[model samples]
Target: METSKRLEQALKKLYTAFHNNELNPECCKQCAVGNILDNTDSWKHLSEYHGALKLNYVGKVHQSFGRKFNGYSPLELLQIEAVFLKACGYELPLHHKNKKPKNPTNKDILFSGLSETVRFLCDLDGIPNVMAYTKLFEFEENEKPKYEFSVTD
Candidate 1:
């Protein structure tokens, strides 16, 4: 169950921010990458536009230099933000006229964004998705599988 230090810290920060009503997909300081980076808006400078994967000059420089913020590369931070925004119903490169969820602060909406961000984080760290529930099915009362993988096969 061990993960990289950054992954563990980021997950804890994300969880705390979500439960504390601090997560805001539109705010650079409160967004997924923001919270992971200790609620700093500096990551915003990594891209020319919000939700864009293409790194800006500063971002490119950092990426080229192998810089990492909170254990995520400049490009990775952008990708994480994009995934969070997209899953939260925001149009890419968030704008004033872009489509967004009716209730951005809704728990369910935030949860969806967090879920996708977590999945991406796990992928980046080459770890299992902690949000997955297949392990729940691994429990067995005796010597048989507690829950069959497929009942119709």
Candidate 2:
């Protein structure tokens, strides 16, 4: 499928951020996965009806990554989540986490597997790589404000 211009722009921004090592873990709450699930009607319906646990799992995965690796960018978080979903056998359009599966896997096992998957995806090259599926927008990095204190005698 042809990617939307908006999505392309978002992917570019995400890639740039990843390259610059400027991702912020604090923004994970508002990351691309959360935003897409929250704003898109189709994703919202899927999460509400069939993928609530899966959605929750994604959050756990994010938290896991955050705890393991500090300073993850929002794009990086989304990329990891996307890789996790795909690894768990979810496809696009629906993008719903498998509600019921022939094989039931343990959450801990799944988390470990998906974490590895994210690490692998993050190491890929170029824009059209595996982790760029979501195609979300660029987030401006939060800069720490500088304060100068002067003493007069």
Candidate 3:
């Protein structure tokens, strides 16, 4: 699919922030939420028909989490962010790398944050439940799933 220029810019910013260890959780969370909502039917309709007015709705979504947006608590919003990130192929933190390091590194902070976010989001409804799919496929097959590592991961 062809990504919108705005979305591409947002992704580049996110990647730079991640690599530089300069990620602002709040801003990244808002951007992720915005990107996710922008892809939804309702938001798409608004964007297509109303143009700049759609930004108002995005802002509302960003603010709504404080008051439990779409019945999701503030904590749940954070989880949704993590799930979204993972779905987009962001790597969560690992406890060990090649069974050598038993502890998490400074960079692991990013993973830990994402991991916590995904854990919470999975507890809610209407969101894509990746765990169910990942687990089912993992156990149903004898061989581990093959993944192509990329610089982003």
Show how many residue pairs clash in every candidate, following the order shown: 0, 1, 2
**Per-candidate local distance difference test:** 0.81, 0.35, 0.36
Q: What is the TM-score of each candidate against the true structure?
A: 0.84, 0.27, 0.28
Winner on lDDT (2 vs 3): 3
RMSD list, candidates in order: 9.0, 16.1, 14.1
TM-score of 1: 0.84
Say which candidate scores most in TM-score. 1
Ranking by lDDT: 1, 3, 2
State the lDDT of candidate 1 residue by residue for 53-92, as single tens digits.
8999999999999999988899999999999999998998
lDDT for 1 in candidate 2 is 35
Residue-level lDDT tens digits of model 3 in 31-96: 344333332233322122211223245445554645533444334434455454443334432112
lDDT of 2 by residue, 1-153 (tens): 343343333344433333333322213322233332332222222222222334344445455565322233334434554554445544532233534223324333333333444344445322233333322212234422122222122
Model 3, residue 87: distance off in Å is: 18
Model 2, residue 42: distance off in Å is 20
Whole-model alpha-carbon lDDT for candidate 2: 0.35
